[model samples]
Every structure is written in structure tokens, then in C-alpha cells.
Target: MTGTAKGMIGFDWAYCRALAVGVQDGIADEDVERWLPEARKVHERILKERESGLLAFWDIIEDEKVEERVLEIAEHFKGRLVDNIVVLGIGGSALGAQALFDALVSPFYNLTTRPRFFVLDNIDPLTFSQFLDMVDLGRTVFVVISKSGTTAETLSQFLIVKERVVSLLGREALKKHFVVVTDPDKGVLRSWVRESGVLSCDIPPGLGGRFSVLSAVGLVPAALLGLDIRELREGARAMAALCETASVIENPAYCNGLYHVIADLDKGKNIHVYWAYSDSLYSFADWLRQLIAESLGKKVGEKLYGPTPVKARGVTDQHSQLQLYREGPNNKIITFIGVKSWPADVDIPPAEEESLADAGYLGGKKMGELFHAEQRATAWALAEAGRPNITLWFPQVTPYTIGQAFFLYELQTVFMGYLYGVNPFDQPGVELSKKMTYGLMGRKGFEEFVRYL
Candidate 1:
């Protein structure tokens, strides 16, 4: 599990070693050793829970029935000429799909022969209005995703899109062009699926939206875009299996979780900054932000504790934020993500033989080399300044690697929750805000909150 392709991804905390007690604000080797048993205990508890069929997300990746169902539906539409694939979702529903599509597919995929993919995660009137104007309703396929079928943003978006689809393609075309992925038997979305007779998929009962990426929530969209959905699941399955073991050293998920929790609890470094060198991974970083923020940022009893999670794109953010990161407060634990190989590369054209002789060093290097070099420099510079950092190196940015990364972080954040003594699955704080919005909007039960506000 430590090799290039065999492991798919690697985590190195060597640079963080300098943060030992005497050197700087870092967790000592002895501390990591002390926490190893604690981490192992958490792992053991998770395994026990999983063994008794108590954990859904832990085993959701290996659900063959869901995979087969998703692929069956995907295969049915595999060869259909879809000019546009509109995904109507928000939060976990939309972010994971967008992250996968951006990371594995081409940046200019829509401009090319592939079907243009758009995830309407927001309800900006002008945005959806513009989208409706740009694509022909008849040739587009609408994927309306909402586990509850009652999410305000998603339902609103589906309504708007459904109207246009019915108006343009006629009422008969709704069942053909619309695909709904929600709860299998419950929720308003499911009722609509049955009445409309449209193709539909399940979000799996007990599966939280943020953690449902590997389920049909993510696979359906990935398959629709021609990505290797099975490979993605295989990658997640591999990581999940490795995580079942009690040894943190052998399990990247455990190791990641330990370091993040240790950095926050022991090192006083409360800000977790993720620096992704690949632009394709930037959205993946966004997905990470939501996972960490919503899951770990919580209060238990009389105490409140959670680290702030931040995202930065390497080489790009190097110019914009590196100065502050280097000279400003040392309250951040940075994780630098780098790709070992890119699918494509473009070397500098020898500086045109005469331009910027001082810049000649970059002449023979590929653009990717510069990207990698800047990450290395940033890590080195940060460590020199006594800033603790770690790296999650990917052998390549493919569906397999992306899938592995997704599980790795998901488990890590969950472990962080256990360490912080909070219920990671529930977001009561966010629900309060949702209640406020519902009340403000004249929802019956939330009227009290609206009046108070």
C-alpha cells in the first residue's frame, strides 16, 4: 500500500518531524507513538461497529447491488447523444460529482466532443436562466439529485429545469430526459420518480450526503461522464480495507487522522490549510473543506473545539498567499498535495533563445515541473519557518487516485470528530441556519425562529 500505482496515493509526514518539542511547535515522535495506541483503539472500535453491521458509510463502498444498479442505468444511456448533462444538486449532492468530473475529466471537456456537464448547485436566477438559454432542452439530460427530494435549492432548480424540459420536449419527454437520484422508497423525490416513470437511482438509506460520494450519488454522474466508475469504487474499497487494520502506519486514513487531530490538539495549530498543486484538484479541496468543516467543527457538552479548514491552489496561491503564510502567524497546519505525473505536459520553449536570460533555468523544464518545484519550495520554506506541514502525494490524478483521496480524507475527518468528542454525522449548527431560512421564507413550523430573528 506504499507504492506508486499499487497504493495509488502516499502520505509523508517527514517534514513535520522537525516540530518536535525542542525544535518547534510540532508533535514529537514520542507523542505520535503515544497516540498510535489511541488511534488504534479508535480503529478497533470502528471495526467492531462495522462488523456488527452498525456502520453504513464504512461498508457502503462495497455495495455491489448499488454499483450494478447504477451501472445498469448508466449503460442504458451510455450511447445516447446528450448535448448537455445538467446535474441539479447542492452540498454533498453536487460537490462530490463536480470534484470527480473536474479532477478526472479534461478541463475543456465541454468544448470538445464530450457532453457538456454542468452542476447547478446554486439557485442564482440569472445563472440558471443563462444556462437555459445556452443549451437546448430537448438534447439535454437532467439529473435531479436530492436524497430528501425536499432540499429547497435542489427542488427549486429541478422545478425550473423540469418546466423547461416539459415545455420544450413535451410532457411525454419528461420520463425520457429526466433522471432522479434520491431515496429508494421514501421522500418526495421518490414519489415523483414513481408517478413520472422516469429512470431513478437510490442514495442508499443511512448514507449521509457528504459521505455518499462513492454511492450512486457520485457514480451515476461519473459514469454519465464516461469515467471509470468501477475503478473509482475499487480505489475506495482498497483504502477502506486497509483502514480496517489497527496499525496507523499501514493505514493512510488512520495516519492522516492522527496527524490532523494531533496538530490541532497538541500543536496549537488550529488552521488546516490544504495546498493542492493541480488545478483539477482545487474543487476536490472544496469538497474537503465542507467535509472537515461540517463534520469536525462542532461542540460537545460545555466545550467547543474544531480547527478551521482552508484551501489554497499551489503555484497560483504561492504568489497570492505564500507571503502571509511565510511571514504571518504560524497557526496553520498545511497539507501539500502533489501529483507524481500528469496526463499531458508542455515544456518551456527554450526561452525563444534570447528572452529573459535570467529566466533560462525554466527553459528546459515542463510546466508541470515548475508546478512541482514550487510546491517543494513552499514546503521547504514553510518548514524552515517552523511551520508544520505534511504531504498527500498522488501517483497520478486518475479516477482511482481521486477515489482513494476521497476516502482517505473522509475517514480522516471522521477520526478527527472522534478525537474532538463530537457527533460528526449531525450538523445541528447548520440546521439552525436552515431553520432560520425556512422561517424567514414563511415555512409553518419555523415561524417562531423567524419572529425571533
Candidate 2:
């Protein structure tokens, strides 16, 4: 089944293509072949670690308890006549949900029938004020997401909003306005939910924040936006089946990882540009940037190499950054994501005879053809310039494709982390800023700053 799917997707020769290209570019092609079997072994292990029941991939979806809880939360909000949903989170908690929402939902997402969903994931005071200004407190609902239940930025924002809601709608409004998603039985937020009588949901244990999107972390917003959460889960399940196979060349994740590893470790390309052809997918790029950076960035030995740089959504950026990419430094890898199909509602007519004569070019090609030509030309130019690049061609930007893409990149990141000898599951570097901020807030030793104040 996995082989059939790979063949259907034209991914059967990816490993061979990667190996051939790696050798031609004078990168360590032998390492790829030698590591191929090991990569497959590790991927299988990961699949087994997550497999349970009918879901071919991770057990998170198959867990009756988890699904029941998610549905309960959805029902709870649905029955309460909530009109607005404000999600308070940052990084993984926010990015995945926002990206999925933007991709799968309408631009005017809440036009008539659905509850409007808003994300407050950053710490911009102006933005928070703007959000508060727009919504009616009497009809709003807040979904607070913090795995630790004590993320300072998330908590700070939550407190400000909570206070405002209390002031406008009174203490009784708390039950109507708030629900918490945090660690199952831990964290300050969980305790607060218990004491304050706000409903609570659990972020699955052993699922790191970056990887929790398919879990309730992402699905809650997805449900609110009227997307088919079950289809997304099914797509993930399909991907999980692919990961179980023991052939590196046949596995999309393995081949992708091999390409990334060769580019970064062997070819000295440290920066990664995830360039997408469509404006709608810009959020997807941002979501992937966080996933790759947070998962792979780590200092090993005396060197300070991490996934330090990521740029996204090209064609527009082609005008701005293409010059630097082509002529500047040989320190980056470009990954192009192209959608192979479009809605029938969008169309562009061929050029007329007069227009063709003026331009001195072909007259009967579709506009999409021209755009794809430019993309192909850019790929050739980058390849000719000794810049390593890869392209992921999706059949279309539906939930199924998005699910496959997300899982593909995520699994690739895991393999890349293993190749780099870093623990992909934990992020220690993110804690540094949090600890420093707490210390600064505590007034424990601010004498140095006191003079300036």
C-alpha cells in the first residue's frame, strides 16, 4: 500500500535522485546510501512508537479518550452559543493552528454561520488592544493554550483579557468565556481551570508542542473553522503508513531528510528558504519555519550551527531576495513548494494577436503556464549556480495535501535531528529567554537596570 501510494505520487525514485545529485554535486553520496537503511529503521521505530488501532500513523488520533474529549469541547462551545474564539498561545501552539485555519478556511472566515476565530499568540500590546477593540466581550470565548500552563507571554495576555472580561461581563462570565488547553494534570493553567470552574482540555503527553498541531492543539481551531478534522486525521494516517516502510528511496520523509542533511552537513548550506508559489501558503511557510528551526537548531561540540535562517513565499520575494540568493553568499538551500492544480473559477485568457506581436512571444499559453515556466526557470538558475534546491509539487492545496506535507516535513526534521545527533523531542534553548524574563520580572537583582531607570 505504501509502495502504491509512493508510486502514485511519483516518489519512487526520490532516493536514487537524491543520491545521484548528491554525488554529482561532490557531497557525500556514500553517507546517504550507508545511512539509508538506518534511516528507514529509525522511521519504522517512530511509526511503531505512535501506532495504535486503525490509524496507520500516530496513536493520538486513534485514542478514543482524546477524540471524545475533543468532541466534548467542540460540543460545549457549540451549545453555549459562543460567537468568537480567541486562542492565546505562541510558537507551535499558535502557528500550526493559524496556518491550518488560513489555508483551509474562507478569507472572510466567519461571514455568516460559524463562530469567528482569532489568534493572540504574540506579545504586541497594540495588536492585543486592536483585538479587544473588535470583539464583543459578552459573546466571546477564550481558548488558552500553554503546554506548561505557565508561559509568561500567554499567561500575561490571558490575565489582561480575563480581567477585562470580568470587568465587562462580571465573574459569572468566566464559565462562558474561558477554556484551557494545557498539560493533562499539571501546570498553573490547569490548576486555575480547576479552581476557577473554567473548562479544560489536555495537550497530549509525550507530544512536543511543535508536533502537537494534529492533536487538539490544531484541531480545536480547525473544528471551529468548519474544516473536516476527520479528513485531516485520515491524511495523517496515510502518512503514518508510509513511514512504516523500510526503504529510504521510497519514503518521502527519508529522501527529503537525506537531501536536507546532505545540503547542510556536507555542502555547507546552513540557511534554508522554504519558497512557496502562492500567497495563501505564506502562513504554511511560517508554520514550517518554526517547526524546522525549533526542532533542529542546537549547538553541537564547539560550533554554533543551528537552523538559524529561514525565508518564505517566493515569486514576490523573487523580486526582492532573488538577487541576494543568486549572487550574494553560497550559504543557503532553496526548497520550492508548488501547487499543481487550481480552482476552475480562476482563469486567464491567452494573449491576442496584437498583444503577441507587441511582445514577440507565444500567444496561446495560459497564465498559469507562464508562472510555472518562471518557477522552472528559477529552479534551473539556482541549480546552475551550484545552489542546492528541492521542489515539493502538491497535487492541490487541500486538507489531504496539507496533512501529507506537514507530516512529511515533520518526519524529515526528526531524521535530520537524528543525523545531527541532537534530541529532536526536547528544546532546551527556548527556556533561556523564559528564565531570564522571569528573573527580570522578579526584581531579584535589577540594580544594574535600576541606575538607568
Candidate 3:
């Protein structure tokens, strides 16, 4: 699992190839070919947009300034005895760092040599209070992230934490313990940093919060944990290059989007399930949920479209949801994500009893072995039941492989947006909710909307 493979992530669409065909439900190899030329054109156009700076997120890996700043900050905290890092931001801000920490580091990371990471992305007072008790305030570092610096949830959390730091160590101590990641020239956070002399970093202009992983938002926390940030960017940069090919068959990202859209539009398969077989990857499913849900669920003029994205864990979801997935409806397209090798494994000892003979087949088997068996069995069963499923194979789960995954999915999302004829970068529905919250909270401009309440 530790060995570094150049292209560790893979995509398999065989079960999709086995699907029932027609104008409504089947995806022949020809359908993939038919869609390739147009998808290629769209891919090329997106690259053009990147070149002109219309899409800032895609250019993150190639930005030398971002990498330099991230590395510099990482170096500052590298050998220091910083015990805990509390990251304050919701959605994109928190999920990316959480996914990286979960996938690349050990589950028992805090107890090990790695600095403990606490991502505060919610407003649960009890949970927030509990975290304060879990770590010593003086030994902890706070990374407050908000691209706009106006997100109410993030600012509220920052206020509570800032007050505690100020009271415990005085206002001057904030300079040593806190760092703000926000817009460089604007936002309340930037102003605060300027006035208080706190250290800070800028989230690249035009980069959305969800796509800020390769930017300072995600890299800061990852670098602090001793991960190879450069290698992670290299993996993403390589994947981005590979996905630029004109042939859809050669581009995994393009192919992935094509199948999902075909299944959703042609067939009645509207539920898109992202089933990851690794416990470490469960949070990654959450990250993808936001990415897919926010990016694709939109309207192109009068047409309303977008497949529902569902997150399910392997082996665990087998017991809970497999029955419905198998017998209930032919409405779901399952994407199985699995690892070829795990960092460590445990062998199941044999049952030393006469009555346990029925379960003897599992004895002396590695946990990962059984996990893969279940995955294959599930795919086989679904195929037999006339269900369509695809597999995303990961040779190993390292920072490099994860970076490849992030870029691959991001590219796939953009391709899907083109297929659906919608802008993938904006979240108008989410903004409406934000406006409502601002009105309810008595924010200045949103006061007019409060009348409805």
C-alpha cells in the first residue's frame, strides 16, 4: 500500500457495458464513441476558459505562488511541538482537509506523532464546547477559513475561539496562534488580520471553496500534518493532463461523466450512488456529495435535470441498503470505489468449535481480502440482477493517489456540467438559503427579506 504507483487510480465500466440497451436504458460502446467528439470539444473549451482565467479552480496546481506560500507555512510549523490544529470553516473549507487527513494519515493520528486536526464546520454548541475541553488552548493552532469572510457560521465560530484565545493568552498572543485564510484585500477576516497583526494567507481569486483544496485552504492543514503536499499536487497535475485527451475512451474523467448522464437521461436510473469500500474514504464520499450535488443539480433554461447523488459505505451498506438496491427498483447506478491494497491487514482466526464449521471458509483470511470479495460479489450480484455498476480502482491510498482522485472527479464534474448545459461553478440555490439566513439574522442588506418571517 505504501509503494508509489504513477497512476494508482483506475476506472472500470464493464458492468455498464453489460447494461440493457435502447433509447431509454442501454449504453453501447458506440454511445460512448458518439459522445466523445462533442465531449472533447467541450473539454477543449473549458481549457480555453482556464487559460483566460474564467475558471480559477483548475489552475490551482500550476500556481507557483500558492505552493510556495503553503510550503513556507508548513516549514514554520514543521518541527514545532504544535499539538492540535482547529480548522474553522464549513463545507469546502472543512471537508477537503478532513478527507486528506483521513485518507493519508492513520486513524489514530492524534495519538501518534501527527498533530491532531479538528475541523469545526458546524454550529453545535455542545460539540464545540466538548472540543475546547479536549485540547489545551495554548498548544492549539487555529486556522480560520472563509473565502468571503462573511459566512455567518464560520464567523460565529471564529468569534468564540478568538475570545477564548484572547482571554487566555492576551490579544498579542493571537499573532502567534491564529492564521486567517480569506480574500487578501477584502473581507472582514482580512481586515481583522491587518489590524491585529495576525498571520494570514489568501485564497486565490475566482476559486470556489469546494475547489480550494489544492489552494491554501486545504494545503495548509495537510502540510502541517507532514504530508508531501508537492507530491499531492503532482498527482493532480498529472491527472488533469491525462484527462485533456480528445478521445473519450482514453479519458477516465470524461468517460465517467458520460455514463452517469446517459444512465440518468436515457434510462430511469436517477439515483447515483457513490459506494466507497474503504472506511478511510467515507469522508471523501461526503466531499463528493457536495461537489456533485452543488455542481450538477441545476436548470438549463426550462429543463430541470440532475441525478441524485447518494453516499454509501461498502460492506456496511451491504446489510442496510443492498436489499432495496437489488430488488426494489432499477433506478440506481452504483459506482464502487475500492483500494487494491491497505496500509495494514489483520487475518481472521479460525473458529475453534464444531458448531462453527459453517463459517470456517472465512478463517485465515485477511480483512482486506474479505472486503474485496464482498465488493466483487456485490457487483456480480447487481449485474446478474440487471443492475448497472462501475468500479473506481485505487492501487493504493496515498496522498498522490488521493490528489489524482480529487482532480479526476473535478474534471468529471465539469464534463457533466457541459452535458447538462449548466454552469458548474455557481450555487444559486445555496445562495438563496444564505440570503434567507442573513435576513433572519438581521444582517444589513437582507433586512427586507425578514418581513416574510
TM-scores, each model vs. reference: 0.96, 0.87, 0.95
The predictions' CA RMSDs to the true structure, in order, are 1.8, 4.0, 2.5
Question: Where does model 2 exceed 4 Å of error?
Answer: 1-31, 37-57, 79-82, 108-114, 303-305, 350-366, 443-453
Residue 401 Cα positional deviation in candidate 3, in Å, after optimal superposition: 0.4
- From the highest lDDT down, the ranking of the candidates is 3, 1, 2
Please provide, for model 1 over 15-99, each residue's C-alpha lDDT reduced to its tens digit, 9 standing for 90 to 100.
7765422345676777688787677667777778779866667677878998888888878787787888879999999999999
Q: Pick out the ten consecutive residues of candidate 3 with the lowest summed lDDT.
A: 17-26
- In angstroms, give how far residue 112 of model 1 lies from its true place: 1.2
lDDT of 1: 0.82
Against the true structure, candidate 2 reaches a TM-score of 0.87
**Whole-model alpha-carbon lDDT for candidate 3:** 0.84
Instruction: For candidate 2, list the clashing residue pairs, or say none.
Output: none
Q: Candidate 1 regions off by >4 Å?
A: 1-7, 19-23, 352-355
| Better by lDDT, candidate 3 or 1 | 3
Candidate 3 Cα outliers beyond 4 Å, as residue runs:
1-6, 19-24
Specify the poorest-scoring 10-residue window by lDDT in model 1. 18-27
